[model samples]
Target chain A: MTTRTVTCEPQNFRRVLSSMCTEPHPLARQAASRFLATNPGDPTTYRTVSKLESEVVERLGEVTGQSDVEGYIASGGTEANIQAVRAARDFHDVNDPNVVVPEHAHFSFHKAADVLDVELRTVPLTERLVADVDAVAAATDRDTVLVAGVAGSTEYGRVDPIPKLADLAAAVDAFTHVDAAWGGFYLPFTEYDWNFADAAVDTLTIDPHKLGQAAVPAGGFLTQSRKIMDTLAVETPYLESTSQATLTGTRSGAGVASAVAVLRELWPDGYREQFETSMSDAEWLADALSNRGFDVVEPTLPLVAASVSERLFERLRKRGWRLSRTANGELRIVCMPHVTRELLESFVETIDELR
Target chain B: MTTRTVTCEPQNFRRVLSSMCTEPHPLARQAASRFLATNPGDPTTYRTVSKLESEVVERLGEVTGQSDVEGYIASGGTEANIQAVRAARDFHDVNDPNVVVPEHAHFSFHKAADVLDVELRTVPLTERLVADVDAVAAATDRDTVLVAGVAGSTEYGRVDPIPKLADLAAAVDAFTHVDAAWGGFYLPFTEYDWNFADAAVDTLTIDPHKLGQAAVPAGGFLTQSRKIMDTLAVETPYLESTSQATLTGTRSGAGVASAVAVLRELWPDGYREQFETSMSDAEWLADALSNRGFDVVEPTLPLVAASVSERLFERLRKRGWRLSRTANGELRIVCMPHVTRELLESFVETIDELR
Candidate 1:
């Protein structure tokens, strides 16, 4: 077969402020090249890669403060969150089950409700744009199977009061899940109490692709116990293995190997430096935008959202500046590794001129 | 950060006969390296890679005989098949819905039923190990919202009579989906009537990772019309785009780029030659196994299944000859790209010596 002459050179993605994504570490890219033929779907077929995946699960568990964590590498946060919902529903065995999440929760919760036929009770956020424990208390009942807390919400980048939310859900024995897809790796570098060490929390959705510099679509789901994880296991006679407990079959071994490689490269010190740098850059950007008359939300991770006029938003976007807008029309910027101080300064300069 | 010294060299995967998997084409591996930082989730941020993904969808649609097809890159066949079921269930306001599939269908059908709260009615296969169209007709009724046919069954590589199955299901307005994950890329090389050109098939689960020589997890879900695909769309306010119809959010751009690279390398002639060589190899292996007194199932693709005693299966497995087994105890062997003639001949000699 003739290889095409088409060149896929990486474009200048540094100006992409809208996406909460980063480039994969060089080691991860190398690992993906090394394991292109492997598939982790059947552990027996690719034992080496499967072991790497399990190591990733274990290392993520340790970061979340769980000594004995049970989970797998999911496609991404959507599948991880959906799998968490499946685990909660099956473990509880309640009829017509419902889940309680804040209105600011990820849209994947809605997808899960639509797919699983579970009633979704979305509580209104507090004035601070965080999940209100009181509202969650009012929404839960004996039939509530799961209650989710958003750590580092997409728009505002605020960590919900997970400890309080878990306490509220514990009264009814509802499973607690923290969607740390954007916050899990960052929280370890901060003094936040959003981890498995919280006794009431049951599951966590962490994406290595977002902050850990893994290749895309590598979402990690960590649970409190193997029993809870096994609730979603289904038999797969067609595969070399007798059964599987994943959202998809025939998944990529490349994703697993790449994640392991990246995690190993940034185990303790390297990741902290990256997180601190991003946070510092975001703080600077927030200050600059505020000085220019923009009311910016205090970033919990490396995300800064500001109340901007629609005219300004449209003008900036028309100028080829990629920015995400919240439902309330706030301009959102995530300070990933690529989002350097120089890029933000240029963006600020552009904004000042436009204003 | 220090790069890890651990090596990830590709293993001798030719013995992995149980998997319907192949090494990614050289172009695909090169593409993954070129586009390691790109993501297809936010089109505005990764416009070029997103266009590549759409091109993949378009080319796959053309191969499946649908000129105006609408679809996306799914996680794998499971997500593609589940999305097809979701579209069918939502298109028709199905309540207490059931899907009728053949007994040899992939386990993803069972996963969909579990996740969607839909009942699965499995019709038994005929004596020839193919879907019994009459049994499917007898099993489906007013509540049957979808009918799925397996073009390439996992255990026994046999194409079902999809035309007959579709005619039977269309009598009651049930949606028709063909799980061609293993056979879609192969059928264009052979004379098979299991495509949308047949008029009865509505959706196809075609996996590039399985036979198109793309990286793992590159499953394509192509629908006959855009109207049906709209049923699966859900609003994603956080994304640059307004909504998403995919099973995942923040998916890897590597899979999409790799698939397009592989497809471009083997568009019309290159893929046909690969399939022909694999089919001939499969025939040779089947004949050799039969001559050694093992009863072999005639392969429709590059898969061969033979009945082996439990002791023999264990011995072969202990000797590192990877093989899959059917629910009825038939050992399966898939002749992928890496499974060369020399490897098969060595395996046969080993079996002869053991016998």
Candidate 2:
């Protein structure tokens, strides 16, 4: 037998600036390594990681102004959003279920609707690129089980008109879900009333991996009560426990531990300072891009959407600039913590030379 | 901010044998840490990890004796199985779809059926504790989109008649899926012909976390043809790449990297030696338990299904022996690579004293 050992040397992996959220915190890495062998299928079978998961849920609730929140750590935004739709489908007891969302909602909503076979009714965005409440009201009906709005949309990072959407959903007796996967952690630091305290949201999808600075694949699903969570639980007869409330079986507890560690370390003040700096950096980048004759949108939640020609986009992409684009073909640059001023300045210098 | 770091020292976390797989290979840890910040969402955005994920898929295909197989890493068994069922549903274009499986199949099937709103028809197991081919034939009909069989059932670790089941599925033009989440890696070393080279299976769900000794949350979904994989792809307009063929968005590269590392380290010879040792250990443990007045079934894989009373189970569990039980109340002990002879000897000594 060959005595082989796999080692990941620092030189083998070069860090890039396009990766947002900075590097994972030291506490998060250590926590992940500690719980690498744990599976949070049942608290009874895996007690340590299970307790850590509960504490993480509690911290998420307290910070989001929903003190009674109940949920589990999902794989990522996709699983969390799918679970939210499933909860809404089961809770409303509708025969022909459908989910209503804005056209600018995350692609995860589309994946969820397709997987669940639920009709996805997408409302067109308003002139401001937010979910138009009038359109949502027009799209929703008796069969509509869920009406969702985004806190930080993927395209423009604009917060939707969630309060108005919630009112409309309440009138139709539909469950309201807020997909705050990218913007949940930042909303607390901003002066926006987008959390559960200010809205009539029934479920929320928060991803710690996005803005919370945890390790990868740590998306959370939160609801107001256990009665709602029970709808997604499945019975696992082989294990010591009889039931599990997760979309995937044998989930890794590493993500949960890393998220809890990061949240515990940077709770009240550290994250706020980081959010402030990231938004400021975004504003600075947007101003630089606009000054250089590129049409850029105003900054919101550390994301700047700009219009660039296909030729320029190809050039920038070939030069190793990781970029995102909207359906309308607007370029998106998320000024995460890792996207420093020096990197943006260098990018601007290149754009100036090209022009 | 306080510089409080979460340290996971070895002594701080105790190791328990209830975990089926051994501690992840050191290479797996290094790979996870190296790619902790990378995601496999878009190949253009995260080029290195995306390429690595593709190589891992190709390696998985070659190892499973399907050189032309195409697939991606999933979150776990549940997601993989669900995606297979979804592929079948979409490819066949069935208005009212249903899946037929043996009664001893994993509960993930139930969850998939519930989420997809597809009717699930379960055939009873034969008296020999394996999936009865005749019963499976009786349960499937015109509306059946999928016919699935378990390579190693969660309860008794008995492999179903996959060859016969696949023949039956082919007769009705249904997509055949083999859920080898528990037994995929082992079958390569055994004399069994349960791989893609031997059966007419369309899709297979193999979890590296179970038997491959990779880190957690590494489930794989492989298809016989790329045409079938295209059915599960969703267009993501925001990302540079317009399409994705995964259930979750922003999947962790840690699982993929770790899985590839371990699979490379232990391929043809290393896994065969480990499997032989594990099987021998199981036989010895089963003999010891049978001699101590317990009714134990001869194992097909490295699992012993013993008939033990609730009282004895409670006593053994209290003494730190993590045990599993079947729906019919039979005790289960999976003799994985981690469950060494010394551990079995200690368990036997305790049972000897109790008897």
Question: Please, what are the lDDT tens digits per residue for candidate 2 over residues B1-355?
Answer: 3445444423321324445545676777777767777677656567777877887788888768898889988888888998988888888867789899999989999989888889999989988888889989998888889999998777777888888999999888999999998788888887776779989989999987778877777888999988887898888786768788888887877788888888888876777888899889889988988887899988888888889888887787788676667787887777776777888888778676665
Clashing pairs in 2: none
**Top-DockQ candidate index:** 1
Per-model TM-score on C-alpha atoms: 0.97, 0.96
Model 2 CA deviation exceeding 4 Å by range: A1-22, B1-17
> What level of docking quality does candidate 2 show?
medium
Reproduced native contacts, each prediction: 0.71, 0.63
- In Å, residue B129's CA in model 1 sits off its true spot by 1.6
* Model 1 ranges with Cα > 4 A deviation: A1-3, B1-3
Model 1 chain A lDDT-worst window of ten: A1-10
- CA-lDDT, candidates in order: 0.84, 0.81
TM-score of 2: 0.96
